[model samples]
Target chain A: MLDLSTIREGDSLPTVVKPPISRSTLALFAGGSGDHNPIHIDIDYAKQAGFDDVFAHGMLSMAYLGQLLTNWAPQQALRSYSVRFRAITHIGDEISCSGRVSEVFQENDEPRVRIELTAANQNGDVKLIGEAVIAVY
Target chain B: MIDRSNIGKSFPPYAVEVENHQLRLFAKAIGETNEVYTDEKAAAAQGYSALPAPPTFGFSLSLSKPNVFEAYEALGIDLSRLLHGEQKFDYIAPIHVGDVITLHEKITDIFEKPEKRLEFIVIQTSLVNQHNEHVGEMTNTLVIKN
Candidate 1:
């Protein structure tokens, strides 16, 4: 559980930087997530679709953001999580996931905290922006 | 153009059983090292009766239904041109391994941006466990390039 007493607005969660995305990782994610979209794994299909190469799935980044939250608190503590895909994450891009406490409030008499989250590549290009609410003790 | 008339259309409810190996594979694919997602003992330590599904695992469950792409086909969406625009999940309860989850899905909205030559489809799903408890809800927006 997240310790509400020890948290303050604006406090940052530890950042998680993943190794550069690789084709095998993308292939593995395709099977893992059951998203077999050719744009994400088949390079020839990607070229046929007007892209020069395959890109990472948006859900992959969202999953990384989920990992960031779970790293701070247990999974059951998560109340809600949402994300908007801002840009395509291409292969070879290293993703850095980060979050910060955005608000502290009570819902249904239970203390909760809202976190603003982000996933960006090594070049600092933001790929996804998201928010998560978690119950705090 | 997507048929706006499909908005509010509900699909047949489908059920999927949660499995431990699936969770482990998903955890590995996402590079998750959290034992709570992979080990029953660690999950018990966290007060879970069984291994807990990772936060985004529900998305995979929602797709587990046979003919998962039929909805898009009915919506006139060419899978080749589709992109995931956004996703949201509201957790009412934790989903655990061995739970049978039933999903109810519907088309909530459809719209187009002529200026960008883009079309958007919003689908909402409600998840209920075998015990008839609401466990989670998901909203998925898919964007199609014109």
Candidate 2:
């Protein structure tokens, strides 16, 4: 898990790789999570929905950020993390997941670390914007 | 066609707990091979209290709840026709192990087109703690087809 004593504000850890979004990723997200929205997996169905192509699941993108946090804190101990779906992530889009230590504080007698999180595509269009709170033990 | 009245109607309250093993299972299935999700030490080095739930972790928080769907079927809308129009959340705090979250649901909005056989219900859920601290809110538009 996460040890707060070792972290510092603006302390950037080893940069992680931002993977490319693939149709296969969407298929897996649909099958594994049971999301299965045609707009997210079938190109023809997506076109009918007014999309240019199949889009990645919004949760799949959010999952990337969660993966990033787990690297910082461990066994799904996150108190809470939230986001707004801003744009459609088309297949083959390159999404870069990045975060910066936005704040460190104390709440309810517990140490807390707040970070502003986001996933942006190669075109610099942001797909999601959100925050995560980690309670230090 | 789905009933217009059910558009803004919220079913009931439900809750789901985040378990460590389940978190690991999701991470592995999603191809999140990092130690932070799979190993405790990697998470510690990165500065975590434990294995962090993946960001979309909010889904697991409110996924399967007992009896709430009874209200959906009561409307006579086919469950399979429901499509998630969107999913969004706001993280107000961190959820640790043993944290049992209660989800309060409300139908925020509903729309029906005269020529369309479907109705859209804007479903909103607030995941709160026992003390009522807001944990997160999940909003999605469900398409109800006849």
Largest lDDT belongs to which candidate? 1
lDDT per model vs. reference = 0.92, 0.68
Backbone clashes under 3 angstroms, per model? 0, 20
Q: TM-score winner among the candidates?
A: 1
- Judge candidate 1 at residue A39 and give its lDDT: 92
* lDDT of candidate 2 over B1-66, digit per residue (tens): 555566557656776666776676576556787765668787677666666555566666665565
Candidate 1 structure quality by residue, lDDT tens digits, A1-137: 66778999999999999989999999989888888778999999999989889999999999999999999998788999999999999999999999999999999789999999999999999999999999997
Error of 2 at A52 (Å): 2.0
Q: Would you estimate the TM-scores of all the predictions?
A: 0.98, 0.65
CA-only RMSD, every prediction: 0.9, 6.3
Per-residue lDDT of candidate 2, residues A1-137 (tens digit) = 56787878886534345568777777767655545456777888777655577778777777777667766764334555766666767788887778777888898798888878878898889887777777888
10 residues in a row with least lDDT, candidate 1 chain B: B66-75
